[model samples]
Target chain A: MEPIVAYSLVLSAVLFTMGVLAVLARRNPIIMFMGIELMLNAANLAFIAFSRHLDKLDGQVIALIFMAVAAAEVAIGLAIIVSIYRYRRDVDVDAVNVLRG
Target chain B: MNVIELIVFIAAAALALVGAAGMVMSRNPVHSALFLIANFFALAVIFLLLSAPVLAALQVLVYAGAIMVLFLFIIFFFVQPGQKHLYVYSLPWQTFFSGILVIVLICILVLGLYMGGVFTAEEHVQSAAMKVEELTSPQALGSALFSRYLLPFELTSLLLLAAMLGAVVLARKEGRGDMEEKD
Candidate 1:
């Protein structure tokens, strides 16, 4: 692989790992949502890099779809967070245990 | 590649990593959101370097512009004034296990890349000679998105509509009160 591709892939991997750490370690819903976004972005980077590597347009198209899906996810997720906060007065994942038996 | 391209790539990659680290390490949700926006910007530059200007533009417009704004709004709306303990990491075991998982994943990625001949000098020449005339332009991407991927494109629009309606229903205060009164 080219140096650029290698660098991008490594960066994507590092970012994805950091995102996982954020999602696992943080209790705040917003921060966890941001982590998910970071992972998606990392995947997008890998997609673009491979698309360039293979000289194809499919990867870019897929990346576009991923972005659209991410936007939709954020819309629904934030709305859920807001509703949860309205009833519970906090967005911490551990604090909202209404479903716990 | 050239000296300038290498330098740019290194700078962008460094910025992206820093932003990612900051997003994970910061205690303030607003700060984390800002860091994520910076990371998205750096990723857009990297996308440009990868010869996908359309993706780069979309990264800026969608992720940095729209999504980050939404995040900031939600952060300010939900977080109360004078709330000191905004971020509490109460799960140490989860963090420890996640740390182990991250290390393992990184090891696997590096090993896979090395074994896949990604670092080989032979593939560099082939990658350099790749045809740029087809996949690098916005027009080409538009054609592919419309003709070849028409179903997915239309489906995405439907998904967006559903998400919008769901957001409205979930966040509506009167709807919540009606459910409470009925119960």
Candidate 2:
């Protein structure tokens, strides 16, 4: 692989790990949501890297779709977080355990 | 192999790493949002390097500009300031397990990519590099997005519409009959 592709892949790996750590460790739902975004971005990076490496436009097309999905996810996710806060006055993932509330 | 490309890539990669670290470690959600914005910008630079200038522009305009602004607005409007410091490293076991998971995940991803021959494949690099400009040109991407990928493009619009409706419904105030009917 080219140096650029290799380095970009490594960076994507590292960023993805950090995002997983954030999702698992953070108590706040918003931070966890950010971690999810980080993971998605990392995936997009890998897609772009492979797209460049393979000389294919398919990967870039998939990355574009990923971006659209991510946007929709964020919108619905933030709305759910707001709804959770409305009921309990807090947005801690650990605190909001029960489904009924 | 070019010196200028290497330098730019290294700088952007470092910025991206630092932003990820800060976003993960920051106590305040607002600060985390800001750090993530910086990370998105760095990723945009890297995207440009990868010859996907259109993706880079969308990365800046959509991720950094629109999504992050929404995040910051949520942080300001809903998230309480006093709640920031209350959850500092509260889950030790969760952190420990997460650290293990991350290490395993990185190892698997990197080794899998390397051993899968991704790092050794060099036959197409020259040809691919030569076509970099054409790959990301508006005409090329637009034709592909509109022709071959038309179905997905249309589906994405539907998904966005559904999400908008969902958000509006979920965030709306609950009327007196809203919960009573469920009970």
Candidate 3:
């Protein structure tokens, strides 16, 4: 509705596209995970914009919850990556595909 | 919509875009992590501009400070010589097609927003005129989190505990078990 909200939404979209690009093109699993984080940040940006527009605290609360989930996700994911790396010196996603059934 | 606010938004948006680009383009994973930190800081500024000061602070503290530090630590601890060049020098067919797909996705999303009349929609009518302070104060956020969102809040804590345990177990060496291997 407002110019600021519109601009922020557009920016969010752009950031999300970049994240998609990173995930698609990069070989490194960590970079792909970071791209996922970028996508989450874009969603949070949109949440904040809508929260301000509606004058509601619900969106901010949701964003906070999203942050907690993301942190937990990163922890478990990096652990998995670390363990995979220990068995097979390389950390490339393509090389780590021992589960291709 | 004042001049200063407009300028701040534009600058922050630019910073965020550059950071995103740098993160994607960097050859080294460490550089990408640093760029992501810059992007997170820019997003925090944008969050503040959106009147979410508490969320903005948390964004900086948790996302940029904590999560990225974890990323950097992993990169440093487990980096291999082969990973020095993370990005491919020449674009593969898949990468090229994916770039085209990204362009199409962005066009669709923006067009969908425009078609949904988001740009022309009127502001939501607030039951009471809210002061800027009341919008996203830490106290208000705390009340909402504790009252209406209590179950979800508690679930988040449980999730974090599980993740902590999972990380410890997953990262432990299999043969050595809990004890350190003697060199």
Candidate 4:
């Protein structure tokens, strides 16, 4: 096995784990969004690695789609965050407990 | 892998991990954003090394450049300087569960990759070299993206349009008279 593939996969896994941790541990919405970006980037890394390993263009194309989707997500997510901030003057996830039972 | 390749891989991996950890551990949102940018750049380097130059360029252009600037703008808009001291980890159980989850995920991924024979170093090196020869150039990527995946490509544009409209609607402020009339 190529050490590069192994190393990249391991790095992607670790980065994904960190993103999950950020989403779970952080109370701020923007930070959580950043976490999601990290996870997306991790997936992109894995995709590019596999694409190289298999000598395929499909993975790279899919990665391109993922980037587009991530960009859209950031746009909508930030807009929602800004709206929430306007309403409550805070972006803390715990504070926006309107959905809580 | 050659010594130079090994060294580069090690450096990129280390930088990526450090950036990720720094993003997660930083209390201030701005600092976390900066760390994430660092991670994005390091990941771009890895993409280049993987023989996907188009993806590397996109990673820097879109992820590191556009998305990060948007994040920073949102952070500045929503979070004032005095309000920067918000709770990062308000729950102890959250941290405990996150730790366990990280361990389980890493174990599963490492074991799965090993069992799948992905670490067969020589074969990987050979294939990787071949891939580098075939190197996914921007023109090739555009050809595949447009010809093979045309529908999804068009749909992504539609998705971007919707996202733009949604953002505008969500962020637009109504007239004060409208709120007073509703009240």
- List the DockQ of the predictions in order: 0.72, 0.69, 0.66, 0.70
DockQ (0 to 1) for model 3: 0.66
Q: For candidate 2, what is the interface RMSD?
A: 2.0
lDDT of 3 by residue, A1-101 (tens): 87888899999999999999999988788899999999999999999988987778888999999999999999999999899878777666766547631
Write the candidate numbers in order of decreasing DockQ: 1, 4, 2, 3
Model 2 chain B: worst 10 consecutive residues (lDDT sum): B83-92
Model 1 Cα lDDT, one tens digit per residue, B1-183: 789989999899889999999998888889999999999999999998999998999999999999999999998888975575544647668878888988998899888888988777554454454476667879999999999999999999999999999999888785436766753
Model 1 Cα lDDT, one tens digit per residue, A1-101: 67788878888888888888888877778899999999999999999989988788999999999999999999999998898878767767877768631
lDDT of 4: 0.84
* Local lDDT at B91 for model 4: 64
Considering summed lDDT, which 10 consecutive residues are worst modelled in model 3 chain B?
A: B81-90
Error of 3 at B110 (Å): 0.6
Clashes of each: 0, 1, 0, 4
Clashing pairs in 2: A1-B119
Candidate lDDT scores, in order, read 0.87, 0.89, 0.89, 0.84
Q: Against the true structure, candidate 3 has what lDDT?
A: 0.89
Interface RMSD of each: 1.9, 2.0, 2.5, 2.0
Task: Please state every model's RMSD to the true fold in angstroms.
Answer: 3.3, 3.5, 2.8, 3.3
After superposition, candidate 2 runs with Cα above 4 Å error:
B84-92, B121-129, B176-183
Per residue, candidate 2 scores C-alpha lDDT tens digits across A18-88 of 99989988878899999999999999999999998777888899999999999999999999999988887
For residues A21-92, what per-residue lDDT tens digits would candidate 4 score against the true structure? Answer: 888877777888899999999998898888876678988999999999999999999988888877767667
> What C-alpha lDDT, on a 0 to 100 scale, does residue B104 get in candidate 1?
92
